[model samples]
Target: MKRVVVGLSGGVDSSVAAYLLQEQGYEVIGLFMKNWHDDSVTISNECPWLEDSNDALLVAEKLGIPFQTVDLSEQYKERIVDYMFNEYEKGRTPNPDVLCNREIKFDVFMKIALSLGADYVATGHYCRKGILEKDGEEVYQLLAGVDGNKDQSYFLCQLSQEQLAKSLFPIGELTKPQVREIAARMELVTAEKKDSQGLCFIGKVRLPEFLQQQLQPKEGLIFEVDADSPVYHQEQPTFASQEEELAYLSKNIAYTPELGKVVGKHQGAHYFTIGQRKGLNVGGTKEPLFIIATDVTSNTIYTGQGNNHPGLFKKALFIQQPEVHWIREDLKLKAGEKMEVMARIRYRQPLQKATLFQFEDGMYVLFEEPQSAITEGQFVSWHIGEELVGSGVIS
Candidate 1:
């Protein structure tokens, strides 16, 4: 029997994954990863790792599978935690969960499983894998889960062709309710456990507080820019090439101190992101104020009156060539090439119609409709039908 190492995350989904793999005649070994160790920085009583490890052990025991815990705290800190701090410090919004899957789970943990003679590493992610023959070569496809409401293909967007080759997602075909029913029938300990809302493996995080541990607080000005600012109505420049046009369209608008009235002050501009509406704590507006942009170098946050702020939306975003990754390498676009694909910048976002343009500088995704946030440091994935072909970090 082919041995499969299941990342039993002590959550209901992973619990059911292990059971299903066993029934499918695969030799399953349950491995729970201890990704975080610093409880001081972690929020108070927010699903501690110790508790999760115990729960994972219980699930493995009930399933009659050999189980062990792997302490990957050092790798987690260097790969995910440190990178998160570095990105936020630079005033960019980073997605740690996506990085976690790409760096730690698939890269580090996968290597360990392979060393143990396992043919594959499985997870409980709500996404599917598909294989097809293309030009006499086996092509792997990363597909959206059957359960539309719970599809997590976006989180695994950074995965490459080789990573998808040995990865298995066992619960992709079932909806959330069906997974719960299966766990309930199995009398699993995680059957009724609520899903983790915090960082991957690192429980509930108070982002501001967690960030404060690494980024020292410095007071900064919050200016509310008028919606009718001249920056919005500026004359378009002549584009010599598609790359130049995309480069201009994807760039963030710079806000000056004189742009608007000083609405409030923030601890730090780095703590905030584009399209943020909360934690501003500034009241007394006709409509709730939303953060339109932030300047970490100037230590200022530019805000707009409401959700309809022109600065809140962008039609295009650029991804550096080095950051771009293609799961379907066969479908990669060459220089000056473009393809129509459905793409989204973040998870749970309904796929929007977009066109991917590839140039020497990088790849750009221009959406048919304006997308909100479009924050830097976040990964954007493009799909054709159900198969995710490529993804890249938003520049």
Candidate 2:
């Protein structure tokens, strides 16, 4: 019998996944990865890890499968937690789920499963994998789940070809409702458990609250820009030239339109991010203000009318790491190479059409029709049809 280790998170999806694999005649082992603790930081009420693990154990018992819990708290902190803190410190949003899927589930957990003589390590992820003959060699292809609404290919993009080969996603073909029904049929303990949301480990805690516990919130100035100010006439340069312009434009950018006066200061430029619409205390404008630029060195924040040019919402994004899975042979791509592929900048964002280009210095560029908020330190995943090729962090 083929031994399969199922990553049981004490959720309905995972419980059903174990049931499905066992029904398919694979010898299933329920492996609960203890990734986080309740004592160190505040955890979401929904994700009671202890209760979840116990529930997973009950499900395993019901199915007559062996169950074990692996304490991966240290590995989770080093790989996921530290990475998240570092990204936020750099003023860029990082996807912890992506890192968790890559470093923890595939890398660490897979190793443990393999050591236990398991033929495959399975998860409740809403993704699929297939084998393809590329360049006379068998290659693993990562596919989006059949249920588009629950597809999690974005988070699984960083998975390596070897990892994909051994990973099984039993719930890939089933919709959320179907998975719930399967759990109900099995009479699993987690049949009615709600899905876990928010950060991968921390759960639904607000970003500010989580950050405050890990990082000191430095009081910074918040700059308010006037609508009629000359700064609006200034051309916003690309991210590369932002530093120089921010230094020159900081003082001149904040002109109050209603009072015809400047008001409020902001913290450093590196402190803010793009697409931020809240936390700016510059009062006076009836329209909602959006942060367009940040001058980290000068400690200034530039605001613009919420409804500016649609061009500001960029469609094209550049990526660095490109992992082509379904393609059999290595593709030699160059700059300006436009291929119709689906790309995603964040986990929650939907996949959109884009062209990929191999730029100089290991950097890859993704060109979408309209520009996107291609923030630095964010992961951009690529897909061809249903197969996930690879992903890289936006520079």
Candidate 3:
């Protein structure tokens, strides 16, 4: 029998994953990873690790599998928590889920499982993995799950080929409702439990509040662009000659000065992100105000009211570190090559059409239709049809 280690998060999805694997005649062992908890003294609704471990133990008992809890709290803090703080400090919007999967799930957890003599490690992630033959060599391909609403390929994009080869996702082919049905059939304790939300271990705490606990409040100003001040460039020009003039004006128009008007006084520029509207007190605007830019050096926040024009959204975005999982070794794609692809800017957003342009400095510029809220420090996942190609951190 093939020995498999299942990452049980004390949730219905993972519980069902272990159940299905055991039914397939695999020798399964349940492993719950204990990440971290906020120790700086604040009320948190985070999942108590003890409670989750107990729940996982109950599920393991029902499945007749050996269970063990690995305390990865230190690793989680170093890789995930510290990385999050550093990103926010740099005024970049970092995705903790990506780091969690790359550093913790695959790196730390996988190594631990392999050391225990398990042939493969499994998770409840809604992603499919399959081997493909390329140039007489077998390579792993990560595919989007069948459940469109619950597909988690975005978070799993940072996974390398080797990780995918030894990883198993038993629930990838099943929809959310189908998984729930199986959980109900098995009478798993977490069948009716609500899905986990917010940060990995922090549960349901609002991001801003959580940040306040870790970071010091530094006062900064928020700037709102004044309509009467000046029309730097108008999308529709009055005359043919003015069209050329408008183009030049648009190119030179500075967004930094405008952002300084709306953010009257903020704690810190790192505390906010582009496209955020809530908590911004740039009152007296008829339409809702959205954060268009942040000048960290000048300590300014820029706000734009009314609908964001298509031109304001850029078709191209640069990524700092691109991690690609190619099936073939010799498929060297050159820079400026326009390849048809799909991408997602945020976790919950739907995938959209894009073209990848490789840069000289190992970076990639994704050209797409003006995507809204293309904020720096966030992740952009790439896909070729239904298969995840690669992902990178927006620079």
Candidate 4:
């Protein structure tokens, strides 16, 4: 019998995933990942780690599968938590869920499952895995889940072919409603549990409060730039190469006091990100203000009056050579080559029409339509049809 280890995340999707694997005749084991134990930093009140673990145990028992809990708090901190703090300190937003799956679940947890003689590791991600044959070689394809509304292919965008080889997503073919119906029919403890929110392991947290734990509050100036400012009409530099053109195009506009009027003050410039609308607390505007730029060095925030602000959109973004990742390495683009692909900067955003330009320094993704808030430290996943081909950190 093929043995499979399912990561029972104390949620309905994972609960049903374990049951399906058992019905399919696999020797299944339910392992609950206890990734965070530090309550001092965790801000959520109800449904804490203890509750999640107990629910996982109940589901495993009902499914008649071996159940155990693994303490990955140490590794989680080092890989996800610490990495997040460092990114925020650098004024860049990081996606911890993506990193957690790549650095922890598939890497660390998979090792433990392999040590236990398991043939494959499984999760409840709403994405499908496909196999294709090319030149007598097996290539794995990460396809979007059939349920378009909940397709989570972006979170698994960084997964490599080898990782996908030994992985199974039993619930990929089902919709959120269908997964819940199955769990309800099975009377699982997590049958009607709401999806966990906020950080990957840590529960829902007030982001500003969470950051304040590590980042001290410092007063900074907030300057609101006009939509038709002279800065927006500045002359562009001629680029000799694609890399130079992309690098110049992808960077944020340089704003000075001459370009905008001082509007208000912020607690910290590092706490705010590009395109953020809320938490500004600044009023008396025709339209709501949105963050267009943040200068951590100057401790300044540059804002624009409305959603249609010129500063809110960009035509291109660059990913450095070191940050580029191709799940299908066999289909990677070489220098001076280009490909037309659909890409999205954030999870759940509809993929946009874009062209990928490869260069010696990095890859450039130029969207046919301007992309809003192309923030750094976020992964941009490109797709050919429904398959995710590559992803990279937006730089």
- Number of the top candidate by lDDT? 1
Badly placed stretches (over 4 Å) of model 1 are none
Ranking of all predicted structures according to lDDT, beginning with the best and ending with the worst: 1, 4, 3, 2
Number of backbone-clashing residue pairs for each candidate, in the order shown? 0, 19, 16, 0
lDDT of 2 by residue, 317-361 (tens): 444334322222244455434456787777668777776655444
Q: Mind sharing the TM-score for model 1?
A: 0.98
Cα-based lDDT at residue 154, candidate 2: 80
1-395, model 3: which lDDT tens digit per residue? 99999999998889999999999999999999988666343235455666678889999998899999998989998988788888887777888888898899988999999999999999999989878887798878889899998899888878877888889999999999999999889888878877887677555656777777677778887777754444434574455643233233223135656323543678788888888888886677788777766766666777677557332365566654344434323343665444677888887688888766554444444455567777777878777778887777777
Superposition TM-score, candidate 3 onto the true structure: 0.88
Global lDDT of each model?
Answer: 0.93, 0.71, 0.76, 0.91
Candidate with better lDDT, 2 vs 3: 3
Candidate 4 per-residue C-alpha lDDT over 291-360 given as tens digits, one digit per residue, 9 for 90 to 100? 9988888898999988989999999999999999999999899999999999999999999999999887
Candidate closer to the true structure by lDDT (higher is better), 1 or 3: 1
The residue-by-residue lDDT of candidate 1 on 126-230, one tens digit each, is 999999998898899999999999999999998988999999999999999999999999999999999988899999988899999999999999999999998
Error of 4 at 153 (Å): 0.7
